[model samples]
Target: ENKAMESRLRQAGFPYVRTLEDFDFAFQAAISKRHIQQLTTMQWIDDAFNVFFLGPPGTGKTHLSVAIGGAAVDKGYKVRFISMDQLVSAFRTESTDPKAHRALRAIRKADLVIIDELGFLPITRTEANQFFQLVNDLYQRTSIIITSNKSFEEW
Candidate 1:
């Protein structure tokens, strides 16, 4: 398990380390303290459901996602974190590139995938379709945590 955990963290691609203890809940009153607290349990990951964090900048979206995903990693779940821009960039090459398949396969094997920063930039129609395919493939099979500046309506 220790060896496997080391591999998992290598693939997790966390921007920087953060934990539940590192977060300041008192300062972010817009977020539901109870809800975030419950999320740290990582039960939703077990159920293969999705989690979304939506708000403007400096609202702790990335912090909360990293914290929750880090919690799951501590519990030995295969977790991966990637920005939407990076995923989209990968999707553009998936059809012809073996490296792209390898990257996508890594995401497939993970138990929890945290996709951060959707809607940070506008995506073309083709890119949007590719992203949809990725989402569809992962849906109901693994947990996905999406952090977006826009709402579902915008997506």
Candidate 2:
């Protein structure tokens, strides 16, 4: 079981390991501790509900997303973590690149997908469409956790 967990963690592609216990709720007073605790139960993922962590830079959005994703992985759910840039690149090359296609396939298969650092870079119109398409494809089939520095209006 331990070996399986280690393999799942590796396949999840988390940039760093973080747990709900490691999060300092005192630092981010705006966040609801109770809500986070509820999320740790993984009920939202089971419902295939999408979660968005939107805030300015250094507000612990990525931290929270990663922590939740880690919790999901520990609960025997398949998880995948990727930056917005990386996801865009994969979408751009998925047609010509077999590796990108496989990556997208893996992402689609995951129970939870964490897209971090959105709005850190600008993408072209075509890329935006591709992103929309991917999101549409994953809709209802997979749960998504997105961490973005931009506000909903800006996005």
Please tell me which predicted candidate would have the highest TM-score against the true structure. Answer: 2
Question: Per model, how many backbone clashes are there?
Answer: 0, 0
Local accuracy by lDDT, each model: 0.88, 0.91
Q: How would you encode candidate 2's per-residue C-alpha lDDT over 63-93 as one tens digit per residue?
A: 8998998888889999999999999999989
Clashes of 1: 0
Q: How far off is residue 152 in model 1, in Å?
A: 1.8
Report the lDDT of model 1 for residue 64. Answer: 93
Residue 13: error of model 2 in Å?
Answer: 0.7
RMSD of each: 1.4, 1.0
Top lDDT hit: 2
TM-score of model 2 relative to the true fold?
Answer: 0.96
